[model samples]
Target: MTDENQRVDASHTPLATPGPPGAAPAAPGRARRLAAPVLTLAVAASALGYVAAVDPYEPGHYPVCPLFRLTGILCPGCGGLRSAHAFAHGDLITALGANALAVIGYFVFAGFMIVWLIRAYRGGPTPRLALAPLYWWGIGAVALIFAVVRNLPFGSALAP
Candidate 1:
């Protein structure tokens, strides 16, 4: 028979290859992945513990930002620590007061992390993000608005 047309006989069965003589048994689900969410929670808890022990609010602990100290301009990361501290303490209002934008960012990060963890543990296909041109432009616009609003006299409350 031609190689293309050849087929195995129905009575014949394929033989299994022998493993190395002294190899230890492999664990079941060895290929199964570990969940990322658990690791994230552990790391976050550790960070919170450190933050609590070394309170940044205490004077002379962390260095002051040159930009904010010199120019009085609030950078994107300003108030991030205070916001995180408030968040860790379970005071949402205080966190928002410290940095509204950071709080919004925190929520978005949390939501995405939760979704990513769920899909990973369920053996679902990894999530892929494809932002349309409009979406990207919208994000830029929002950031611009946040910058302007935070600096404005009326929106000073939003400032860090």
Candidate 2:
């Protein structure tokens, strides 16, 4: 055979040696697979820790919500920081009172993180939200409704 043919054959060879017959394919290293989830958890934990240490209840520590300041209307995210502070301090009732929607969001985020960590540990594909357009619109609608309700007199309990 010509050198060109030999080179072509060499190029077609597998990069790694084949494992024993019928053996399952090798997975990524545990550390490599867990890196993203662990890093994400660390970042989240750091942020929560900061919020827990700092007092959002105290003036001047955090910026006021722009929408609430300008319009005097309670936007959906208006009390989110306060909610986080309360949540991090183990005050579930206070957190919910500050912003029920934000409290619910925290739980949803926790659930997603748990699923992601589990899947990553097992070397499975990363978890995706993958919500359809309808679901996206539904989420938007819920936020809008929450904002409106929180601003109304009847929803004073929901206000921060």
Instruction: TM-score each candidate.
Output: 0.69, 0.86
All candidates: CA RMSD in angstroms? 7.1, 3.2
lDDT of 1 at 124: 62
Task: For each candidate in the order shown, give its overall lDDT on alpha carbons.
Answer: 0.74, 0.90
Which pairs clash in the backbone of model 1?
none
For candidate 2, list the clashing residue pairs, or say none: none
Per-residue CA lDDT of model 2 for 27-125, tens digit only, reads 879898889889998999999999989989899999998888898999999888899999998999999999999999999999999999898888788
What's the lDDT for candidate 2?
A: 0.90
User: What is the C-alpha lDDT profile of model 1 across 49-115, one tens digit per residue?
Assistant: 7765776788887788778899888766677788888888888998897788788987887787777
Give model 2's TM-score versus the native structure.
0.86
Give per-residue lDDT, candidate 2, residue 95: 98
Best by TM-score: 2
Candidate 1: count of backbone clashes, pairs at least 3 residues apart or interchain: 0
